[model samples]
Target: MAGLAVPTWDPQTALLIGAILFEAIVLYVGYGGLERLVGPRLMELLVGGDSGVGQ
Candidate 1:
């Protein structure tokens, strides 16, 4: 028997959590950059050439 199997705050678990958080931040920044580059143009195309953002 492995005796009282209590959970421990392992380094691997901490690292995994950190990696997930880093990925989320990176994705957010990437999407925000993409939006800044193309969002207004995309909106204009969809709304027939009058972009509300520019005004």
Candidate 2:
């Protein structure tokens, strides 16, 4: 494992990691919005009741 160690803080690695983080955040927000929009119906269908969330 020690032999596999690589340099850190290089620009390309930073950019790649940053892009992945940004994409993750975007997906999270997008899915959250979609859930907010239709989650109640889906939950009702699956759980057979209101999701226990106060409307």
Candidate 3:
């Protein structure tokens, strides 16, 4: 005969969950900083078109 098993809360499971949450927060903050640094340059490149030099 065979038996069925169910999942339970344990230290390893908690550690893995915590690690994933930490990674999500880190990525969010990092991408936000990168966007802030590069967003202005990208907007200028898209909208300026390099024609307004002497104006």
lDDT (10s digit) by residue, model 1, range 1-55: 5877977898999999999999999999999999999998888788865557667
Lowest-sum lDDT 10-residue window in model 3:
46-55
Q: Which stretches of candidate 1 lie over 4 Å from their true place?
A: 1-8
Put down candidate 3 lDDT per residue, 4-27, tens digits, no spaces: 767678999899999999999999
Worst 10 residues of 1 by lDDT: 46-55
What's the distance in Å from true for residue 29, model 1? 0.4
Number of the candidate with higher lDDT, 2 or 3: 2
Candidate 2 lDDT over residue span 9-42, tens digit each: 9899999999999999999999999999898878
lDDT of each: 0.89, 0.86, 0.83
Candidate 1 RMSD to the correct structure? 4.2
Q: For each candidate, what TM-score against the reference?
A: 0.75, 0.64, 0.67
Give the distance in Å from residue 9's predicted Cα in candidate 3 to where it truly belongs. 1.9
Ranking by TM-score: 1, 3, 2
| C-alpha lDDT of candidate 3 relative to the true structure | 0.83
CA lDDT, candidate 1, residue 4: 75
The predictions' CA RMSDs to the true structure, in order, are 4.2, 4.3, 5.7
